[model samples]
Target chain A: MMRLVLGLVVGVMMIGQVAQAQNQPLRLEITEGVIEPLPFAVPNFVPANAAAAELSSDLARVVAADLIGTGLFREIPSSAYISQITDFGAPVQFADWKAINAQALVTGSISVSGNRVTVGFRVWDVFSDKEMKPGLQFSGTKEGWRRMAHKVADAVYSRITGEGGYFDSRVVFVSESGPKNQRRKRLAIMDYDGANVQYLTDSSAIVLAPRFSPTGDRVLYTSYESGFPRIYVLDVGKVQRRVLESQEGTMSFAPRFSPDGQKVVYSLSQGGNTDLYLMTISNGQSKRLTSTPSIETAPSFSPDGSQIVFESDRSGSPQIYVMATSGGEAKRISFGNGRYGTPVWSPRGDMIAFTKQNKGRFHIGVMRANGSEERLLTASFLDEGPTWSPNGRVIMFMRETQGASGRSSLYSVDISGRNLRPVQTPDGGSDPAWSPLQK
Target chain B: MNLVSKLIAGCALMALAACNNPTDGTDGGPIDPNAGTTSPGLIGDQTSPSYFQQAIGDRVLFTVDQSTINSEAQSILQAQANWLLANTDYNATIEGHADEQGTREYNLALGARRANAAREFLISKGIAGNRLKTVSYGKERPIEICSEESCYAKNRRAVTVLLGGLAG
Candidate 1:
């Protein structure tokens, strides 16, 4: 098996002098309100060998982009730097970085040995003049420098934010083109940063909601190949797929993988009524989860796999509900005025991201697992399908324009309801499902 | 499409009665049959698909997030059922669609419910279940592009598209 990446035990560790400037550890956690973004600096990663020269700056750029994109950290322009970092072991001139209002500093090195490359990086608390995190290194193929850079960025982000890193992840979504009425859709995968996009299915078949497996190797999606919406699973790397549902009369869609990745939960429409069903991926055996006459779909499993949260119209209008994985009476969690759907359990297991429609406008919002503390993160003409980032700190969703010339595109927002930004895609994108950080 | 094309298509259906008739209707007035034979369209031609579209109505509108058949929808479905019985060879693929107002999955389910609502209405009127198929495009397909309620009401619709060759 070709493992794409592996972490290496650094033979040489830079043990800093551990300067004392502040009592509290360096962190960028902001609660309840917006503040100025923390300013940081990333000098170009130094190429340790001649072979790594051309790609060193590119590596540093990706790291900087990942950190800046979060809206939590701002990069102090290199032009404003008083001192330049040329080596990984060079001690951080805290006074110089502090003079430029830099709270954190990052230094990295790229060493190439044939097709294999090793990347080592360190984060420094510029104010304290102490190491923010222990030095570490990642080794991978030269062609995968981007992933290596992402890994570095992930480490830096996590060390400062005290949260899991989402940079080293992928998103499976439907790439759309043409007009709103006659749209052409295909299954496409891309890096979380919208880089290295690769198509998984041709536009001949209409595809939607390409959700990633827990392991991030396979994807579950809905397609209209047989002139009916059906669930399908595709091996992302191989670009091979097969129909997961083949019932004669029923049409299935809105599929998701269980937390264990052993079973699938999807909605099956039979005789005009929709309900949720669980199917074992190994044996293709099925079990009915809900027997509701109302529309029951968009099932997402909790991180613990003990329960499933889904949207159902059993309460008259569509509302978020929580029921056991084994099935029973679902407790309605959303009691607000608007209709709520697409409730996704956050990976952190504390929040559920969802889509809401009220007063002709749509919103992406989050609430506690029990539906308390409802917070709308974004509102737009048409915003739907909230997908949590791997860290559960951000939510990505599709926003579509109105009319025949209208189109759909992806946007994301921090869970705090700040920093709403568009996620760039080559073509229109919708139904984004973010994968867990890649192994 | 742009405002010009949207206006033309809306005018063709007479849905936007405010638009001026191309056949020299004075200042946004109704079309005159005497001005041009084609201007009358195939509304009176009962045997044609255009007749089904322009007269009997091949589509029905639903209120925001509703699948229940309203009174007007019931009347139209009655006409549709009578037409289907008269035109025995026709089968329809009921395309259910939602406005850009809901989640993709829920809108898809909503569309399904709307399509099935129409299908059940037809079946109640003695149409065969095998002769009807349903698909929901959710918010993916919108006939009207405006973000306002005017266009949203039109986009929230279920259209019964006729297939001529298949005589099931």
Candidate 2:
């Protein structure tokens, strides 16, 4: 009996030890508080070679520009910096950074050998006095120095925000000019910050809705060169293009690439009836996806190729619908009072961005995949055609003025319905398509 | 034959042909020599392009965001059909347009519906379908550039343009 009592006592002690080992820090409490932008410092990169002397400082400036543009972070100018970082290998002076009230510090170095260049960068948390992430390096041609800088900024952003970075990306949009009645449209591409502007097509034929391929090598757009709307695929690097083979007496428009980039989904109008169609990019083989008499267009594929989210007027008014890629009945996802169209699925596959019109006002909005938790990000005289940033944290769309001027420009807003701002462009722009992150 | 006698014979033959085929409305209505005097208006006859535009009307309007042809639009379309029937030598191209209110793709499809609605009605009114073609400009081309309802009502329309031939 004494041995049994001793065994019970030992079991109780073991249970107490297990419970104590499972103890964790108290969960963070929910409360309202003032939100302020985080302050960070980006020291000019060290030049390891004579050729990289100028590029080193230029790269650092570009990196700082990217982080500040997001509005989530602020840059502490070099004038306020307590100490300079002269060597990338040297330890970070956390006390100096903390003296300037900087929460994060970014340091890097650049080296140019022959035609190739290498950039290495590191990020540190000042209060913690430790590296935020492992230092990383990128190598590329001398011409791509800016891209490498953007890559460094992207890494820093991802580490700090706990979300993917959109710095290292491109945007393809329709550039507009001339008067409101006879606007001339040309296809133009540039960096996400409106740099490196390149015109892909002239204003001879009207172009609309340029979509980037999954690999960022090609773009799909609708052109009126044949006196009717037809889809054309253009190679970004080669600047060569070819019209997608289509049946005679039919019009095709609103083209989008499948997630895999091997197929295109667009709307085909045959004998006055418009429906959704899927076509292989290589051989021109196509299959009909929707057969309703009503118009079905603006199709976007889910990150996975299993389903598609598109706009259809089959329910009498324009609304968002989700259907299988193989073709089946579409479940209506938008039941709000307003008409919803231009449904684009987010890359994260958690939400779908759309254009909604209600009470004569247009709004850019997002909803969960199953159509719950709808939030309107921006409202304007005319707002439509949303394109998600590479990270899916921001939505870029077209916004137009109210009066007879009828000028249109590209604008972006965070998915959480803040930081609404216009994206700068040389001329009036619309129908922006965000490219995937570069390799 | 003598030169004088031959000339007289030719003149006599021309006079006889002219008498046989009289110029019925060949003057193409009056020259309207006073066209710009009392009023600087309408310098052409019934068959002129300006006359067709001013007298018969070239476009029909619809309600906001709708493609259905109401009674007023149907009356205008009926007049258009009659005019087209009278001018069989000419072909028509119907351009569908929308206001600046809707989404681009939806406006395109709506404009197509408007144009097709008008084309089908013209065909039903005995106008040959082959003589008519339809295209939707969507919201790209706006005749009334203002943003008010007054302008939008005029902007949502289908215009029938005469192409001057029967060829496709």
Off by over 4 Å in 1: A1-5, A14-23, B1-51, B164-168
User: What is candidate 2's lDDT per residue for B1-168, written digit by digit as tens?
Assistant: 333234334533555323112132322222111122121124133333344455666688988878888898797787777666655555677778899889988888888889888999999888998877777778887877888999899889988866542221
Each candidate's TM vs. the true structure? Answer: 0.88, 0.86
Q: Tell me candidate 2's fraction of native contacts, as a decimal between 0 and 1.
A: 0.49
**What lDDT is reached at residue A398 by model 2?**
95
Instruction: Point to the candidate with the largest DockQ.
Output: 2
In angstroms and one decimal each, the interface RMSD of every candidate reads 1.8, 1.1
Candidate 2 residue-wise lDDT at A151: 89
The residue-by-residue lDDT of candidate 2 on A37-145, one tens digit each, is 7888998999888888989789999999988877777899999987898877776777799899888888888888997887887777776766664677777788777
Q: How displaced is residue A422 in candidate 1, in Å?
A: 1.2
Off by over 4 Å in 2: A1-34, A113-115, B1-43, B166-168
Which residue pairs in candidate 2 have backbone atoms (N, alpha carbon, C) closer than 3 angstroms, thus clashing? none
Residue lDDT tens for model 1, A1-439: 2245555445545445566967566888857688788999998888999998988899989999999889888999999999988867766778899899888888888899998888888888887878875777888888788998999999999999888999999999999998765688998898999998999999987898989999999999999898789999999878899999979767899889999999999999887788999999999998999997889999999999889999998878889999999999889999998899899999999999999989878899999999899999888778889999999988999988865577889998999998889899999999899999988
**iRMS for model 2?**
1.1
